[model samples]
Target: MTDFDTDVPPDATPHVCEHCGRPFARERYLALHRGLDHAAALSDDERAAYETAHDAETDDLRRFRLLALAGVVALYFGFLLTYAVVT
Candidate 1:
């Protein structure tokens, strides 16, 4: 598997809507759901900004996890190169 394929943490749970207690597959979906269903009227620009920020917030976990995996891969290669030089 690719380094980006990080496993879900045992304690991690699906995103749930606070208003109605409905579960969503991803947190971003909940943000859109809330905006469309529950939030106050927002201007077009405000809505656009909110959606952008929400995407980053909800996707942060996966993004960081992939970065961590990339870090590990780098470390592994660094170790191998160091070993070769030592030998």
Candidate 2:
């Protein structure tokens, strides 16, 4: 019933890996999977593409972690300030 509990549609995965026919919701995910799972079979161009996608994904994850930490810190300070004013 929650927003996080929403189900994914069957057609959500449009990107199919050529190496394994495995489907992924995003092309980047497919690239990553291919890089990790089919490294032995990958050509030079596919490997390069995977490296680009992996770097982008890593940067995005780092940014998300920093933002989440900031949000948590802000909430903690806000709660402390509220308690100080009320008490």
Q: Identify the leading candidate in terms of lDDT.
A: 2
Off by over 4 Å in 2: 1-13
**Taking the tens digit of each residue's C-alpha lDDT, what string does model 1 give over 33-84?**
6777766865575467568857777699789999999999999999999999
Q: What TM-score would each prediction reach against the true structure?
A: 0.37, 0.80
Error of 1 at 50 (Å): 11
Most TM-score-accurate candidate: 2
Give the per-residue lDDT of model 2 (tens digit) for 1-87: 112222335757467777666666777777898899999999998899899999999999999999999999999999999999999
Runs of candidate 1 with Cα error greater than 4 angstroms are: 1-55
lDDT of 1 at 53: 58
